[model samples]
Target chain A: MGETVIALAGNPNVGKSTVFNGLTGMKQHTGNWAGKTVANASGHFKSGKRSYTLVDIPGTYSLTAHSPEEEIARNFICFDKPDGVVVVCDATCLERNMNLVLQTLEITENVVVCINLMDEAKKKGIDINLALISERLGVPVVGTHARKKKSLAALVDAIDGLPHGKEVCRTDYPREIEEAVKIIEKKIPEDCEVSRRWLALRLLDGDLSFKSEIFEREGKALNHLQIRRAVSEAKMYLDKSGIPAENVGKIIASRLVEKAHEICDGAVTGETGYYKTDRRIDKIMTGRITAFPVMLLMLAAIFWLTVKGANYPSQLLSDFLFGLQDDLSGILTKLNAPSWLHDCIVFGVYRVLAWVISVMLPPMAIFFPLFTLLEDSGFLPRIAYNLDRPFSLCNACGKQALTMCMGFGCNAVGVTGCRIIDSPRERLLAVLTNSLVPCNGKFPTLILLISIFFAGSLFSSLTSALILTAVIVMGVLATFFATKLLSETLLKGKSSSFILELPPYRRPQLAKTLVRSVFDRTLFVLGRAAAVAAPAGLVIWLAANITVGGATLLQHCSDFLDPFAKLMGLDGVILTAFILGFPANEIVLPIILMAYGAMGTLPDLGSTAEIGTALAANGWTKATAVCVILFSLMHFPCSTTLITVKKETGSLKYTLVAAILPTLMGIIACVIAAEVMRVTGFC
Target chain B: MNEYISLNQIKKGEAVTAVRVSGSSSTVRRLTDMGLVENSIIECVGRSPTGDPAAYLISGAVIAIRSADAQNIKVRRRENG
Candidate 1:
């Protein structure tokens, strides 16, 4: 009555989220699913006089409750009772997509089949007769190019017209199954709202969820014992007919496939011959001997481009911004402005912005676009394929490796990506171990430490990059080891089988990749860092300038945290900054600068050696630097990650574990590093 | 002869039927969800470019079950093969 509730459901990478964002603009959280962290999304839109709420259900292949996403999707549709459901399907893969559509039809028939990416289908020379599909399915089927909003108006009109539409005749399953379903229909209680045919099919397939649900709904009158007896009777009858429960599903699927093929026989046509390019390329890319090397080379190229291309721009931006700050300070002094205003503007705002732009922005700008390019090119799936075995060896889902790889970009995003792991236990394992992968934020700390200490005497800046790469490799190794250890111990479970579809390599749309990377990832990071950095800058300025008992506020806080920091192989200042940096990692460096500034003035990045000198002056040794870097790499996630974890798990206990586990690991690693250094006299 | 067939050794187009699932619950659930059951038909789609394990098409979805997981799952070659 108030607003139309429209649920969007589809398989992964079917552009459901893209469709949601296209409809709602850039005002939606495109993270993991709410509560379950299963990649569910919901957004709102207004069309004409009616407001519509679109719930993006997790992308699932079927409604058989194979994974958490599938279960959540099935439950939401059945229980939540939405007004209308939009089932988005891939236009190019209609046969496979119809499996889900047919399953949805078995449930409530208040549905619209939206065949999206018609343009891609067209490019592949595949044509669809929407009329025939509608006729076969007995539902409204709208063909759309969701990315371009093509036929979006038609979709809106369809939604509005749903209430007035006639009851379309639904498709029928096999006659034998249909007959069995009819008999079962009469046995089910009249008050049960779910379609009898659907329940019959589920029962025939031995679907545990349906059996449990029916048992629970029936309560004491039909207990589990009775339910099990009934199921066994049904199984006996089914087996006597020479058809097993599992065979029923296969028969149904194959029948649907046959129908889909019949409908598509003449409706669609494509090039009969395979492309030489695909074969030629696949020969090398999928080659047994060359694949690993090629993958490594490709990854190295991407990282090299990111690091090399980012340096000059990063330096330039820092100089320009910091120079503007000095000019603004002089102008304010000339205007006889208050010292507080000067400190807030110059030291607080400018310094923080400088650090953000100089450190966070450039790498992100270079990295995200390249990452997007690889993703668009369909290369990331190969990375998952490559790492699958190693992951399986650790008794974890192969998809966990993919999630960890994503964490190298951002932990929150990585944690969100764990939705791909179908098993609840494996998904949780992936989420917990994600923090072990150092993100872009941690890269700056790694680079600085490695550059100053490890690569200072022996090699050039290139060697510094290599050392940084080695650190990343180490972090990945840690992630694998941690995942293995956790899967074998704390969260013991069998790993889920994941089918990583290595999509055909295509030329990535540079424009789309660039825009999305810049807007979605780069700007998102910049905006969050800037928001926290400004206030943090102000706080740090006040702490530094406002001294208490001849000791700054920072010093007091650091002194308080000193004992714990020492035990963990770090000093008070470093530990205090890490604590304060819980909100955003970009703020950690700025906070450290402020802490040092409280003690004595330090020069900017113009003279790199000056920063090293200042650190040495402040009693920081190579051992301390190494400890700080390791701690930064392994420490608890920022506020964003914690919030994501809470949202994903929907349990304070799980969120606390996600937070504390990493922090504990970080502390232990730092302690070991410090003690080893101390005993070896490396400091 | 009870010759073992690891998933890694499965060639493209080879058909096998699952006899049992011998993995952890998570792995078992995942495999079962992928339509792997006591008697599900599976055809090896292809090997990874590196060939450590093969990709198989089962129940319409493509899954890369590792050699270890595959070794645990006993399979009899389809009679047609």
Candidate 2:
């Protein structure tokens, strides 16, 4: 049997990916769309002896080409001409979704309307008349609770039946639109594969479809002037009908909406009044009085939980990994390996790898799932809704709030999430400022610094947690300021307005969120950090072990940096450690510990007293701790984030800015902090 | 009495009928495409914590619109007789 290509299309936040995942199972490849930052995922499935390749297009509200995602989705359906298209709709909000479905129908007849989220709809007492909708639209309607595998079988069956399905019912437009479309339709070339009526409607609606895009696949040059003249004539004809040329698009959109309403009149019934639960929750969550405080408390709570949960596991992992070094050394002694090789491999390479995993993994494993829970519960959009004004004030996208939240888990992931912002200028602002939020890797260092220097005697853990939150709050404020400055100077642009949809709050799928965050986020970030840390560990080992003149290479480098580091309230050893820790932030403190010769390997700071004694021995004061913490919060991103920023921006210049901008900030901040502490005699 | 006003002027929990959606082409296209066409009923259900962009119940979807954008969407208050 011949293979079939199916395009999955839908409105944003509708469970299109759910249905795609249900059908394709685990056979999927996710990559950026050709020459576009937008991510595309494609997979294959088998139905009744036929292999089907499913392309999951980005979720878009319309095919009007107002945004890249919408354009990509529209281009795939119109130009690619897939064998079947599954138009997924949110069952709870079928009316709004019908606009996209109607648009898809105008392009291809081999389409199926898959009403997803049927479980949510059923729970809300919304009954959808699938057969009635199918009859009305003249396409197969498959009701699916896409999350449940069993419920998707009918949807798969509908796709299988697409080859034998009835003729697609074209949406009837208003009289003025129909007359203008007829004029434009006569001008479209006869050999075009896209539906003539769709092309005519697009031309009338002032679509920006380039002539090259129209016939690029056919290797033919289209008569661009002919199409433009035909479109203008259509608009002129509609203008004579009293609808202005500028308003033609609205009129066409209204006609399709009117048709959607007509179809929904009898096909959708039941108590749609049960949004009361979501409303009741939103009342507190987004209420002006409670929102800010609640947001702060939530941030602190997640951080505190991560700190508490990761402490023991990180210690155990470190102990276990370091303990393996002794046994390996014992085996090496029997094998008579060179002393330098043993030391380099075990102490330098293996130890740093272990330290990164032990320190970075536990926090990320805890933080990412907590973050995903907020996302799955639909609270992240509310955060965007609340912060939209502030972001607008900074001339950035409100969606930056979502990306910033992702940054808290890892800045690299946050940089990737910047793709959601439509405007390139705003996205660049987001990408550059994303590193201001301290990620999971930096948490270990911050927590250590705070607990050792700032934790008060009374309620130490709570005090440390509050101080940590304050530092994060400071980082967020800095992000806003930096974004403002960048917008004003480097990347000037008006703030783009967006419709932030606060999706209906549902019970978060805890199990799926955990598995997804663990593998997709936590493990992915850990793997990247480990890959960089291994080579870094070897370098750190070589520097420490290799002798230069009378002193070791590490000692010589630290000696060279001493004066500058001293001016910044740090010493030569600490500055050299920070520079060497560039590959991953998780190894910074461990590097410092190793350089201090406090321990031959990364030491778990058992208590604030032990950490304080070590720092004190190195000429550290409260001022030094303050400067280090500030510097740690503001410094250049780790190697992984820099690579991600480079990949995302695709420019060496911006990547350099991403690295240098924060480093400059960190240096200035440290200098000021150190000077203030010195003048105040606090040191 | 039906009084024409911008959508931003509508009070929380106040239901209105969309009279006309006029703004930047993209904004207008987006609003109308989301089923906020003429005579379609919309309700201001909630407001953000900072209280600029309010959530409106439109076509069974909760869409958050900033006050600036909301000002462009003219609506008429639906008074219960």
Candidate 3:
């Protein structure tokens, strides 16, 4: 099944992933390539009578590597020697994607040009003459709508069809470089399978990367005496032509662009001013006057939908799960299991697990799909583009806007999304501040506080939403503050080059997106929550049940922390709850209620009124409520996010900063809020 | 050459032919690879809300680049536009 590995390669946003998924379906494994952090996915699928494994390489704009992503992409095609490469190109913008395609073609003639998104191209009144492109590239070219399964028949046939390593239209360099190539082309080793002329071009380009990559791939350097002499002679000849060696890389790239321009002329027609519809929409989207309001409205609408939509599903899920708790206890009793064992599994682990799942699932289920739709519709980049100036002021870029938006769903996902930020400085800053934005897990807690203290039942529902939006704004502001603070002190650097491509907007595929978002984002986050929920549940159960001296362990810990918590205008129980709630924010209120002796067990407090009653009985005034909300908004990210930071940054130092930065800010904020309330006698 | 202004200096909706792009090796190389080479017709399609970065239509791709980097590219008014 692993035989005949074919590489699926393309530029970013070209729907290469769609083609890969259609070919591989669910039978795929994502693994690291050459120790790089980018996803390297490969899958096995059968075509007619043949079974082939396809590896989807990292999407790169060019084969001459700059970033790690580009490096992985170039190294794979140059060294991995897959049976064939299918370069997926967006039909609407074929010329831009051709750099990678043409580069792949130069490396090896075993290529199939997959012109994807044919439907989008037609909508733009663009026509592609497939035969002309096929003839020009001397490779089998197939056009298809990657989303529709039936349209892929020709593509699959091409994958199964090609052994045609016909002569390719080589990327012609300027006279100086061409003369250099001629000096060395015939000296290339015949046994080496890479195109000889391409090898000569790379050597003349002074590509040091290929030498090391060759050493790793072939276990030796290209030390052929004749080849070495020819390489030097080519360099000597190039020097005689008065072309500076420093400009060789740029010259080679410019020549490749020119060649791609030459190939696209006439073969693709009616492409001028193609994105008229998208341009009109983008005007309002990025319009100076309308941009910020539209962004905020879109955000609030998504949050509103998530909160309202999750209500019914969350109730049903919790009811079903809590119902199973009784059956589980009964089974334990029937088995004559020890009383302690039954209580540990039932009250301790099972209860917390059920609580986190019910609270986290419904909202994420609604939120992630909506977020994915925004991303799929291509509006998310506009958010980055519009916000770039603000972020650059913080020594970051607008890409962090994307990560911050994801933080609204889950901080861990946001932390992971920071990988897209190219600079290590900005990435770390983004990761460290991601938790400042309240995630969906904390939304329930924040809403409960707002409902009880700020937006009491006297206020309309809109007031509560406005208050909640204000809280999110505070978190976003806190993120910027922390980011600026870190940039000035810890991660000081000028911002890197910020380049974003806003792809043509297309209708999002609703069905596939729903299924994929549900599985990939919803379940993935839920799974991480459950991982810590089980263990943290046991510890919280132990703290509540195991008595130290007279009171329970939970009570003693709360009493000890009461003085410090008082400085922040919160009681000890509130602070202790936050500490324990490091696993999942949803259970924080329940733990506080349990510690307050308001309920004998962790009651999934049925309503905001119920939770409010418990807090009011425990002496939670407006100051306390404000502090608690602020803390939840700014506290250390949950255990799940910390682990992700540790994995992503692979540095304990950065992960520690990620955990401590927001917590320190939260503590400072609460302390100030509490003192102001006391001094002003606002209570 | 002095007659040509930097790309970032162009007004939105203006079209220019790139004379050359000069920057750090990485930036210039990447720009060229994305088809911002010599003589390529570049059009400033839209400016971001804050006006620090602008979207340019280069060879049919809408690329958003910050003004800091765009300042490195030299361009002149398109003769044929």
Candidate 4:
């Protein structure tokens, strides 16, 4: 026999995901806020002799299908026909969570109510009478602190004892609607797999613009002639009463909300006192006077930590990796491997792969965890809340700010995160402008340039970090500018409405978040960079080594791009390096160093000052460094982001637009900077 | 009779009971789904700097509703607060 399939359902911010992870032993990113798990995640777990397939449906407020996520949650519960459903509810706020619970009960009798976050509830001085509620709802209810595995044992036990015949205490609809529901239920086919009561509610519900969709989903079961006649008859009966036609959906919703609160009267008790602690923190974090400064300081602190924390580890890693190249070369020589093969393998592929890992790993390891910490603590939603007004001024949804934050990690991720924006036009706008702000992959190069030219020797790291923060601010402003431009011209539309939920600030699970984020985001991005870097290193090496007439192919290409590069206050070698860094941004600096090395005038690379001196010898000016930073900031996204864009939008045209928009911006910005420097005699 | 006011008109730290949520737009539907039904208590907890979206405490959750959508929701001040 197949495994017992159980659908895990709940309202937003209810720890439904936490429960899923506890049961399935899956690392389904438990970021505790609304809409994090938009796409359903399915995993398997075992209990005693029985195995269960658990589908974690998106957290939603209702089954009424007001949005895509809700629609998904609704359709899954109705049509999927799982063996049993485990509705996870937030114990601290069961009243709101019950809205989804009673609606689910209306559909299925095989429900095991898992009252999750018992710890949070207990902390809030809220108490729930689980046994009483279980009896009231005619379902087995288990209380659990989802983070504690022992607490989840009761939940697993309840899943094994899947309750049947839920004599659920649901609110009765008003008499007119009740009469209408009865008529519809009487006409619904008994052989129908769908619950008769649920189907009746849908059939009698007003203005179901997606009625055909539900009917189509149920495979014509509710589309029968008798059901239609009964529904219209019920509507006539509703009209005969004082209940207006349009008021049907509203009235039905009101009953459920009332019923949910009523059910909680004896079962759940205690006020969180308007979450006083969280409210106090929100006053400062999202306060009108302090919000922007707090935001900038938070961003700056994270970057400062990332920059400071990553330096030693990065240096050590590169030293170890690059130090091994000579041994590899010596081993190749002893094995009588061809010089070209040895150079390609040791000096080319191995060196690049090593550089990518050493450079990308530490910063990502530091940055992603801090970012995840913010995400876990509910601060990110507040950021979206605070920024919504400004973002809306661009004619884009404020959620774009969330996606932009994701972009600070990686543009590919930013593009995927664009899924949170509902409107196609705004999502497209986000996708197109995402690469304007550099990802962590671009940070190594940006930092190197800043330290060399902008930051004076004293407090260099601090100065560079602050300058990096300013550069990020520049990128953010550019994002707003570009979004506004596109919204006006290409992707014009009114901003779609989204309910921004500022979830109560829970203490972030610090240790757990750090460890999981390292595995989830840091290593994943590093793995991709390493994959791209090795092959790219080999290609760049070949381009530099392979001679064309008098000069190497690398030199020839640079010479060809030299004049245009100068127009941007950069030289040929820098331009060629940017072009070669197409596969991954991590290798751009290494490529520049390698090109300079080929000229035989570059010094051995180690310290920043020594490298700066080498750059000066190679005709690099402060203006050149500034231009390089500008170009790097605004240039086309890596090939990975482009492919992601293509896959996301399913349009080659937009993918090209994503690439061209930033590159054009970079060229214009660099040329203007270069011209201004020349005119001002600053170059 | 307690006078009805648009939700945004309620100042910060004020609590009100929802009388009726008008309109059939997706926003109103979302508001209803999130437990802004008639007689449900909503507290004005905070406001954005630009004064467009005001965050309300409803059903044990902080939900930010823009003034445009807040106008659809009619409420009366709660004496308790």
What is the lDDT, from 0 to 100, of the residue A188 in candidate 1? Answer: 64
lDDT of 2 by residue, B1-81 (tens): 566899998888889988888778878787877788888888998888777888898888888888888998889888761
* Candidate 3 residue spans exceeding 4 A from truth: A27-38, A179-200, A206-219, A223-236, A458-461, A584-587, A597-600, A681-683
Quality class of the docking in candidate 3, CAPRI style: medium
Per-candidate TM-score, chain A = 0.84, 0.92, 0.91, 0.92
Residues A158-237, candidate 2, lDDT per residue (tens digit)?
88887755777788888888999998888777887888888788777776553346756643534667777887888888
Q: What is the interface RMSD of each candidate, in Å?
A: 5.2, 1.6, 1.4, 1.6
Residue-level lDDT of model 1, residues A11-81, one tens digit each, is 65566766777776643332211112264567788888689988888877667776566777887776677
User: lDDT tens digits, residues A1-683, model 4?
Assistant: 99899999988777788788888888877776667776779999999968999999888888877645566777888888888999998887788888888988888888998998889889889999998888888889899998888899988888888756557666688888888888888887788888888888876665363476667876666556766788788888888887776778878888888888778888888884368798889889888989889988898888788777877887788778778877988899999999788778887888767767776788889989998889888888888888888888898877888888889888987887787675678889988999988998898788778878888772457878889899999999999989998889888887877577777777877888888889987888888888888788888888888887989988899999999998989899999888888988888887887788743212245456766887888898889988999999999999999999998899988998899889899999999999999999895
After best superposition, candidate 3 residue A77: deviation in angstroms? 2.5
Clashes of each: 4, 0, 0, 0
Work out the TM-score per prediction.
Answer: 0.82, 0.93, 0.92, 0.93
Looking at model 3, residue A516 earns an lDDT score of: 85
lDDT against the true structure, per candidate, is 0.71, 0.80, 0.80, 0.82
Best by DockQ: 3
Error of 2 at A405 (Å): 1.2
Chain A TM-score from candidate 1: 0.84
